[model samples]
Target: MSTIEQPRPATSPSADWWRQAVVYQIYPRSFADLDGNGIGDLRGVTSRVPYLRELGVDAVWLSPFYPSALADGGYDVDDYRDVDPRIGTLADFDEMTAALHAAGIRVIVDIVPNHSSDRHAFFRAALAAPAGSPERDRYIFRDGLGENGELPPADWTAAFGGPAWEPVGDGQWYLHTFAREQPDFNWDHPDVREEFLTTLRFWSDRGVDGFRVDVAHLLLKDLPETLPSRAELAAMDRTSGTHPLEDRDEVQDVYATWREVFDSYDPPRIAVAEAWVATPERRARYAAPTSLGQAFNFDLLTADFDAGQFRRIVTENLAQSAAAGSSSTWVLSNHDVTRHATRYGLPPLAGREGKQGVEWMLAGAPADGVDRELGARRARAATLFLLGLPGSTYLYQGEELGLPEVGDLPGDRRQDPAYHRSLDQGTWTYDGLGRDGCRVPLPWRASGASLGFGEGAEPQPPHLPQPDWFAEYAVEVEDGDPDSSLTLYREALRLRRELQAAETLEWVETGSEDVLRFRRPNGWEVVTNFGGEPAELPAGRVVLASRRLDGTLPGATTVWLAP
Candidate 1:
């Protein structure tokens, strides 16, 4: 039986809240500075609760604040119940939760149930115990399993560029999907499942409204022999591949277990999966009413800039949901990869080079930049495409400002683990520029050094000089400027909130190869032109625009039409 209290009929989003709700994801380390330290913490986040509310987001996904070694940027948790010292103490988290709740914004924290940092006490105990010992069984420990009994378990590779298996002595080997310092948890073990359940309860009891499950599909894998090919494994040596982490049948079981536990809480919490798989069948299974409320659709992440391609991606997702009897949630980008600005319809930057010209053109700028208008126009076009889509959209930090990837971090100063991995693998030619650029701290104000993201001045200046036009593009500056991108977002959000638009979305007609159209259940039309040429739109009151579509939207643009 669900312990969640059913809200009064009038309290439901079907009547009010959800419809066009926006979720702003805050990578705490880069959101704001509270202690004069360059790092952003819970207090800094707490101070900005109102800003999120003002931005019209109904929820805020606070990335992991758990105690960690900072390896893999806090995904390697040393403890789950406490806040990291660098971020703050548990008390700060309590205050942050209270503050966000008071302001009407729900809080979602990242939960890493798939693995833990090697420094974690549980891992320490497992290491100290003998092979086959009760504690050792909590992890994937096996003796006498390698060739000459000297190699790792099977030939699985690590997502961080090496063998997934590492020796733990005693002739035993352990698995690590990512960094060696982070050991994968044995979800097959009953104890592992129990411990994670307790961790989930600890946060929910403390008022976390939901969780953005970290690499949720990594809970299980085939037993060495049945794993993907060495060639296939090597190709994904740098992704959440290496071992088969996702679209695995066993992952659904984990979601079912967590869902049962979550249902015991009040207000009915939500769970989201960071699934980057194309197996929509398996993806949908995780969204069963008894499982997670949301799972990311990587189709858009891999989508090409064509009307047919876009339609297929969106339609396939919707069909998958209907077939599986599940609801859907959408996202543009998160903290893990390169920013969308550099991912689609843009030029080759860092992580995207050596791929294809299309990838650059998708996230890169058009050849013509008579002025900065080309970049600005591309930014608006991307934003329109993002906002005009159906389902819940995740706004990565600083993406609303059309910020590009940071191209200036010195090799020594680079903070991403991917860069270090590339260097270790002798693939040092790869630049430290990709996603790192989009992950830099949010430039809150441009008055002083660090751009007001920290107290006084930062040891380093803000990444990419602050956009001077922010005087016109910023949230503070655009509340009054109806034509600003920030203002446009605000208006789009408001229009989406209008009762009729909050329901499900449906694709109506996509006539023009360059122009695509979809209808909101509320009778609003969302249209776009991905081509680099002007395209016509059905005449209607324009609520959102890639360039204020008065007649034709320029190449790579979007506009919302309402009768």
Candidate 2:
């Protein structure tokens, strides 16, 4: 409602700001609550612009705030152009964007292009129209395989679980890669493609800095004859090749068109694809010059905490970025999976692939070899190591406060479709499968009705309950402590901005195999000791350390040094 200065354009003549920018991810529903209705909204996010600016991030990537049925946590969009009433209105979004820009931070909103909420106008029209009508062509509607049409058209399973196809009467079934409420759009349709381009322009015209493309790799499906069963597809190695319905070659053409719209702006807008494809080479294609600017490199998220594993993933990711002539985007956690703090604390599980690793983490008992202290320590070190890397990095909401995954969420409070889907498969408990844990509202104050997340006459409860231990990790508590995780993040980000290193990484070998060391083009060196013993620091002055350092760096610690 008040006048605010607009942020400078994101583009720079000499360098791409995104190449090494630190982007903070804000999950709106859980970020902060202004009206105290217990849900976070656009105005809530607007009020936090100063907090982000103080944290020293170049941009803030807000998850979807569009009108939705809340199925799949707003991923199933009923309308992409309008904001969900629960979040705020278009005016609120403009206010938030202006406030962020005034704080000198760019804005990147999530764009879910893979599917639309079944309640969407287009989907609703498709459902009411005759099977062969043009209206029905907007989505992936097909005839049943059985004579009576009782059987699903394909053997594909949904990513959340259960059958990917849901029956919709008249021997017709619609494809939904996620929940049944989310119907996959037919990318092959000329109208569908044009609609998304219009959506892109709508936001860019409103001053959005960029977009984080949801399910970026899942726009196109393989030819019917080449499609494989869910079982066989699951067994295949993702790092070796592509999947039938995921990351198909046709997806690139869609991004190329989106890229054209981005380039039309004065300071070209950017996009980062959430493409979880197989192989770094395949992933690199998504970040090609004519496609999206960046694709999330998630190898580090699943890599073992071992030094060797980290080195291999880092090297491969850097190589992939070089091949594509684009800077890689590194991330440790997001809304879809377990938080890194709890994950790093668990014992490494060998021979696990794909979602199996996440399952193993979720199934593990707190008393069964899981150490929260160790996990926190490793997470801090991991943060320093990741921030020191060559390219841009993303920090999930509440990660800066050293938040751990709440694995023991009550079944009644569980909202993720994965949890309900697991129940559908006859699993009694959906403990780890659901993503409600990491989606909990942040603890801003040590004590409050909702931990200072909301302000209303009545104490507004968070969408999900915060654990009893959350108070200890509250922002107010950590903000006052110099050694707190929040402080560590703030300092690390400040130094990263100061260094402004070129996009290059060179490994510096330490004699100990457990110690990983590397130097950046800005004459900054980073060292991490994964061994049980201390390792001598590289020849330089220590600028920042994840933990207190004496003459040597302690095990499970990292330090940034200046030559």
Candidate 3:
């Protein structure tokens, strides 16, 4: 409890700092390990303060570290106010928070408001209580359909794939949009709504800068006895549409209340909603000034490497965000998705919708159709382009190292609920491929028994296997390589801050629609070549380039030039 690293005093509001901040996401379990258990812990995060400060990020968004049964990768939060014992203690969190603040980096912890682990005290009590008990009122529980109550209450399917309803015996069932282990909360309940507000104040008081509201749009108004049909659900009604179970109008009130709680604090604990809504316009509501203040724009995350696609994604996102008076965000890879390096490297289909279907992702990323080198190159160029944009940037942990998805993960050892719950008529579908590949523990050293994660000498294997090739992207290996992706990112981030006194973007026509060329209000421009042959760079002094410049910008390359 030394004063030197204790939480700093709150300051005046940060005046919309999130609009242009660079937020790095740290998937706690995969970030770094402290206990010899091979899983990352809070103390481990405290140990990385210098590295985070060195990266020049404004804040770190720590993914769920709440107590859980590892169902749905800790999104099945059992407790809102405390850290899991396996990860570390509440004292560890406070220390980590203080340590991060001491480095001038803020903290944004994940808050899974939509659901709770079935093992949670309330959920367990609800299961044991009678059908109409107040305990059952805290969760969505209903009687089954068939005569013997053998059928689920509705035909609704879980996001991961199986039926959304889980049997609780006694002819009753509970609703879980994700896995059965994660039972959705009854947002209609006063206790549920008030409890989250308390949770928010608890963390804000603990010195967290913000909350990354998980599944921010999935909370419900109230669950009716009958549910909407699949066709009705598919018709998004111009994207502002709310589904019967998922999105509803009342959820807006939930966010408004949370916003009030957030702003009540000095410096105002800000929030970014992880709302996967139907349209960009819908997503913007979560970022409305009176709401979470920011919402993640994920269009780029699922987009192909084609230049045209990136332009359209950014343009559309910007328009939607502006129309709603909210700033846009850009992200490439995260713990939940297949890493961008792998996505961009795969061979494109002749006329298919996406680069490829979920098949390649589910099939261990077979080498037959992948070009790792090509993918890494696009990923590097893409980051440069994003840094040149006019809004906030979110960087997934291993992206700076150009880590490819470890798609060859053995199925037997996988822990993502998507793999185990995606059962449709007893056949495993493409959706069954969970996000284990991208969530593997990060490598800190080029050679170590635990990649210098935590365990010394002898250690338990990481929850997910790390491919031997991870060494190439390990901190020890890339720290010394001038041309490494790690170096490129550090330099790009530094220059981004210097170049982004800009609030507006001006398109620098490069003749070809296939080349992305845009200049910020400052005299710096970012040109990325995606088409065949070389795209000429605009006349300016070179600041940085994803690849060595040989007079012209080569395809899959990007460069920033200063006036």
lDDT of 1 by residue, 1-563 (tens): 01212211222322123324478889888887777577788998988776665565677898888888776778899998888898799899999988877776778899988789998888999998887788877777655465555866567667766677889767888878888888988887898888889988999999887888888777886566444556775465333233455556667778888888887766667787876664676677666677786776766655555677777787787777656555456666677665565555344233344534333322322223112455556656656665666666788877766655444445565666666775576442223333454566766664456666776434444433333433333344444566666566655665655533543567666566777788876677878787777876667788667665546677878777775
Which candidate order results from sorting by TM-score in descending order?
3, 2, 1
Question: After superposing candidate 2, which stretches have Cα over 4 Å from the reference?
Answer: 1-15, 225-228, 231-244, 351-368, 427-431
Each model's lDDT: 0.67, 0.84, 0.81
Better of 1 and 3 by TM-score: 3
Q: How close is candidate 1 to the true structure, as a TM-score?
A: 0.85
Q: Return the TM-score for each candidate structure.
A: 0.85, 0.93, 0.94
Q: Pick the candidate with the highest TM-score.
A: 3
Q: After aligning candidate 3 to the native by TM-score, how far in Å is the CA of 148 from where it should be?
A: 3.0
TM value for model 3: 0.94
Cα miss at 489, model 1 (Å)?
1.8
Lowest-sum lDDT 10-residue window in model 3? 1-10
Poorest stretch of ten by lDDT in candidate 2: 1-10
Clashing residue pair totals per candidate (backbone < 3 A)? 16, 0, 0
